[model samples]
Target: MSDKNDSATVLPEVTFSTFVLSLASSALVHLGEVPNPETGNTSRNEALARNAIDVLTMLDDKTRNGLTPEESKLMRDVLYELRMKFVARS
Candidate 1:
């Protein structure tokens, strides 16, 4: 007999490679708005732009140490795009 309160617990190993892969995947989905089909429409485009900004902000904070020079340049480019979109909306 097992206690009802006892629950099975599972934990996956965390590694640098896994972390980087997860970050990259998340960044892609947010930047591309993969799950939101109306992302490019005028009504939803602001939301998509905001999402991209948020993702870039998070990546800049989390992966500062892990990013290569090329990755940093790409991040900067994305940031610039986000800024331009924000300004355009104003």
Candidate 2:
């Protein structure tokens, strides 16, 4: 049996939202909207940012009718925010 007080040992559960958020954050970095964690500088790369956004769009299409309502909304919101940011930064 596991102990009740194991919060320190337990890791956060991975979910679709977390995955999408990770990609979105990376895309923002590529678009120079966020700084590169390693370099402490923002490097604008539209190609990479667009690619990431495309990947997310593909995921949205492929996962249609498969995600919960909340999950679907989160994915849409993230994509919208990323796209808008990409456009503004371009």
What's the TM-score of every candidate structure?
Answer: 0.48, 0.83
Output the number of the lDDT-best candidate. 2
Q: So what's the TM-score on candidate 1?
A: 0.48
lDDT of candidate 2 vs native?
0.91
lDDT of every predicted structure (CA atoms): 0.57, 0.91
Please identify model 2 stretches exceeding 4 Å from their true place.
1-12
Clashing pairs in 2: none
Give one digit per residue, the lDDT tens place, for model 2 in 41-81: 97899999999999999999999899999999999999999
TM-score of predicted structure 2: 0.83
lDDT of 1 by residue, 9-86 (tens): 544567544454444444444444344444542233456556656766787788988888877766666667656656
Q: How close to the true structure is residue 69 of candidate 2, measured as C-alpha lDDT? A: 96
